[model samples]
Target: MKTYHGSCHCGAVKFRIVSPEITSGVRCNCSICQRKGALMTPHIYSPDDLVIESGEDQLSVYQFGTGVAKHYFCKVCGIYPFHQTMRKAGYYRVNVGCLEGVEPLQLQVEVFDGKRL
Candidate 1:
C-alpha cells in the first residue's frame, strides 16, 4: 500500500489516503462527473484510510440524485479532493488528479455508466 497526499488547486485544502499504488481510475458519465471531468480511484477506500491533514474547514459538500453520496471540494479553489460513495457506506473515492506526483491522464481509465442511474 502507498500513502498519497493531495490538495486543492489553490492549496486551501490538503489530505492523504492510503491505497494500493494507483495504476488506473474510473470516469463517470453521470451529470455531475461529466461536468467536473475528474478521474477517480478505481477502488473504494474506508474512512480509516483517509486523513485530512489540514483545511477541513475549507471544504464544502455537495449531494444530488438520491443524496446518498457526498462530494467534497475546496471552497477556496473549487477543486474536488474526494467523495463518499453511496455504493458503499463510509467508503470514499479520491480524485486521482488531486494526488501529488500522479499523472491522472496517463492512467488506464474505464468509463462507468453512471448516467443511467
Candidate 2:
C-alpha cells in the first residue's frame, strides 16, 4: 500500500492514508456532499491505516438523517477532508481532493446512489 498526504485549506488537520496509486472514486448525491461538492475515492481504510498528523481538536463532525455517518471537517477551514459512513463502519471515505499529487479527472469515479439510501 502506498501512502498519500493530505491537509485542510489552512494546513491544519493533516492526515495520511495508505492505498494504491490508482483508485476508484465515489460521487455522492447526499445533501451535504452535494453542497460541499465532494469528489472522493472510496479508499476505505482501518483507523490504524490513517494517521491524524495534527489539529485533532480542530476537527469537527456532522451527522444527519439517521445520524449514522460521521462527516469530519476542519474546524478552521470547514473543509470536509474525510468522513465515516455507517454503511462501512471502522473505515473512512477519503476525499480525493485532499490527496496530494492527484488530479481529479484522472480518477475513475462511480456515482453512489446516496439519494436512494
Candidate 3:
C-alpha cells in the first residue's frame, strides 16, 4: 500500500490514507457530484492507515436521498474534500484535489452512474 497526504482549502483539515495504488479513482455524474465537481478516490483503509491531523470542528456534513451517503466539506472554505457513502459503506471517497503532490490527470477514473440512482 501507498500513503497519501491531503488537506482541505485554507489548510484547516489535514489527513492521510493508504491505498494499494494512487491511480485508482471514480468519477460520478450524479446531480450533487456534477454540481460539486467532485472526483472521488476510494479510500479503504484500516484505522491505522487513516488519520485526521486537524480541523475537526471546521468540517460539515450533508446527506440527501436515502441519507446513506454522508458528504463532508470544510465549513470555512466550502470544499467537499471527502465523503462516506452507501456504495462503499465503511470506505470513504477522498477528493483527488485534496491530495498533496499529486495531479488529477495522474489517476485512472471509472464512471459511476450516480445519476440513475
- RMSD to native, candidate 2: 1.3
How do the residues 1-117 of candidate 1 rate in per-residue lDDT, one tens digit apiece?
A: 999999999998988999999999999999889999999999899989989999999999999889999999899989999999877857999999999978997999999998777
TM-score of model number 3: 0.87
Estimated TM-score for each candidate: 0.95, 0.91, 0.87
Question: lDDT (CA) for every model shown?
Answer: 0.92, 0.84, 0.80
- The superposed Cα distance between candidate 3 and the true structure at residue 17, in angstroms, equals 0.4
CA shift at 110, candidate 3, in angstroms? Answer: 1.8
Q: 1-117 in candidate 3: lDDT tens per residue?
A: 778899998888888888767676778888889899877875545446667789879899899988887888998888888887666565577888899876788777789888887
TM-score leaderboard ranking:
1, 2, 3
> What's the ranking of the predictions by lDDT, best on top?
1, 2, 3
Instruction: Indicate whether candidate 1 or candidate 2 has the larger lDDT.
Output: 1
